[model samples]
Target: MNETRERIALLSKALDLMTDRPIRVMEVCGTHTVSIFRQGLRSLFPPSLELVSGPGCPVCVTDQGEIDAAVSLAGIKGVTVATYGDMLRVPGSGSSLVNERALGRDVRVITSADQALEIARNEKTRLVVFVAVGFETTAPSTASVILDAHREGRGNFTVLNLHKAVPPVLEALASDKNIALDALLLPGHVSVILGLSPYRFLPEDHGIACAVAGFGAEDIMLALVEVVRQIREGRPRVASLYSQAVREEGNCLARDLIDRVFEPCDSSWRGLGNLPLSGYGLREEYSSIDALKRLEISINDTSPPSGCSCGEVLKGKMLPRECALFGRLCNPSHPVGPCMVSSEGSCAAHFRFSRGGDHPWKH
Candidate 1:
């Protein structure tokens, strides 16, 4: 639309104003990744401005261990594992949730968290475990579902809380010396719950510029403008361009709901190693609903297969093509890592939008 074009123009002007040095701005949202590529965002920027994808995609960042845990739950008799459609194909220990779903396992893909609650209510005999994966955006809904189930006395409903917090991963990335990021475009949806306040550490502590960005061409463009302006001014502070949704405190009610029902635990991510307090777990009172507890499943807790550079890609040290399996073996049809399976995946976005073309940053 006209709005998209105007935003693109604004983004170009912002990049033009960045006459100091190469500005490495990363979009920290999966939806932003798809939008950036689908709208040809890189094409709009000059060689001086480089936009990198970050560990923003919840499905992509959902650790292999978590998937393995989910798969193990599917292995249990009379236990149904429900998840989003995007998570079905994500590989987990040489197998996938999709393949397991096809093998007549009780794995159902639901659109919303409430649907999982419904399944639990209807199938009282079957233990329904919703594989909850996402950041603040989806966490609220998952928390709401857990609250609803408890209020309605649906004892069969349990959530395998693989929900991840963004700040830890961001901190991990910032501390790693391999990456040379100048600024980050934070995920708009996540800012809705955790808010831009949590991002204070990145700018204040780390001296990295971060702009909270909204999804869509216009929104992304505006975020770029903010990032560029901040860098140009030499002021590394967190700015919220998605003010329509994100706030400094975020949705406190939703956050309280999650805090009440779940507790933070050291969880692993696909590319990122074990981070402190990155994962959430259901409260002990809800242990009966905890599928892993009820089913008595243990995660394999193994490392990635040899020669997979998913860790490098997740750390923002390597691009998708840098991985051996990227295009040759890991296509959309056959994904080796979570980064290639999901639409917002870095590999998927690049292959879908930038492959076979000379990237502006390359020249």
Candidate 2:
């Protein structure tokens, strides 16, 4: 514990030394956002350095159209929708999975993709559709389960693949002029799977300093220090500070599993609209278990609530507190948006940990 504090103090001093000017850094992982706030790391940064949250929460980023589609899927007769628990309360155009479940629709919260497959194996008469939503970190597990279902001839098993690739979305964010980010604290979990190769574009193409960081205070501080150091040196590049978990080459086996079962496709985000080649679709070989193909479900684009600024929050354009609905009409108990509904969401994290404003340490 003492060593962690000393390391953080050194990193904080390093950050203070390098941050001569205002630097806006976005932590592109929901877990990072929560960790920053939970550990009071937001207060440790230099006054010139600002940390913002990005579209890192999978539940928060799952488009309203996709949510509505999943809700619609749940209402279908003989169809059982299996999804992560965080997705249960995310509002759709009209209803959520939880609401549908209450309305007698068979929507079940699953801890793993394999559970959905097991449900399919047990209930042969019913169609079991797993709503797969995550970044590259979780996609390999979902892919593995899909393959298992295919091999076991679980004809009733299918997956609504809302799994998104992180690189394309990061490219989109890097190109956006409005954000004008100086650096990025990359997701450690996703980086463990993708390695450092996929993120080279951030520094090479956009001139943004980025570093892969873990959830711990020391790990995040090390990454932040590296980012500030890169900025100070005028040599913006991608660095892996969380080398214990992340590698330069990433996990080849996991990538192989993802590639074997899924193909790149255009995907829509909550705020970022449709990004090219940003989502994963099951490959032709896995069409038998592709929920959209097998179930013939249509997904129509839907807008957010009238007063919710969840989209702005997801894009790092607006803070969670800036939204009028935050902590007022939209608490975790009665969420007005996905950002409030999701545990890893920026709004939820802010609501739980933040006292008033951006400066949590002050309060």
Candidate 3:
């Protein structure tokens, strides 16, 4: 614990020395958002150093059109929609998976893609469609399940592929002139698959400092200090602070599996709009398991909630509380937007930890 305090003090000193302007470091990982809140790391920062949440939460950034497509599949007579629990309460255009489930639609909350595959194997008559949503970290697991289904000839199984790539979106964010970001805290889990190579573009191309960070408070603090140090030295570079789990080349086998099963495609983000080559679709070889093709589902372009500023929040342009309906209308119990529905969401993090105006940044 003393070691933790010492690290915090060092990071604080670095920020105090380097932060002449508001240095906005966005953490592009939902787990990081939760960890920052849980560890009270935001409060430890100097006033000039600000921690902002980005479109890191897969569930939170999932476009409404995709959610509607999943809900539509759930309502089908012989189809069962399987998804992670975080996606249950997220409202679609008119209805959510939870509401559909309550109305007797077959929507099962699953922990992993393998569980959804097992459901397909057990229920021969019912078509199981797994809502495959995540970054590279979870995409390989989904790819593994798809490979297994293909090998076993599990004709009943299909995947609604909503998997996104982190690096592409990061490039898009960096290119955007509206988001004045100083540094990036990359997702450790995603880095475990992509390695440090994918994030090199941020530092090399955009002159932004980045650190692949772990979830612990000490890990985050150490990463923050490194980012500040890079800025202080006038040398922005990508550094891996979570070297224990992530590597420079990442997991070659996992990346190979993902490449084998999926192909890059243009994908729409909640706030960022359609980014080029930001999403993954099942490869033609696995088209038999591609739910969108098999079910003839079309994802219509949809807008966010009427008054929700989730898009701005996801882009780090606005804080969760800066939204007009953050707590008054969009609480966890009754979420008006995806940002409030997912536990890793920025709005949910703010609601859970800073609703009482205790967040140091609010001052």
Off by over 4 Å in 3: 357-363
C-alpha-based local distance difference test score of model 1: 0.81
RMSD of each: 2.6, 2.0, 2.2
Clash number by candidate, in order: 0, 0, 0
Clashing pairs in 3: none
Report the lDDT tens digits of candidate 1 across residue range 191-249.
88887678899988877888888777777777777777887888899988888788789
> Which regions in candidate 2 have their CA more than 4 angstroms from the true location?
356-363
Task: Report how far residue 313 has shifted in candidate 1, in Å.
Answer: 1.4
Reference-based lDDT, residue 339, model 1? 82
Model 2 scores a TM of 0.96
Instruction: Please give each candidate's TM-score.
Output: 0.93, 0.96, 0.96
lDDT of 3 by residue, 28-55 (tens): 9999999999777787787988889999
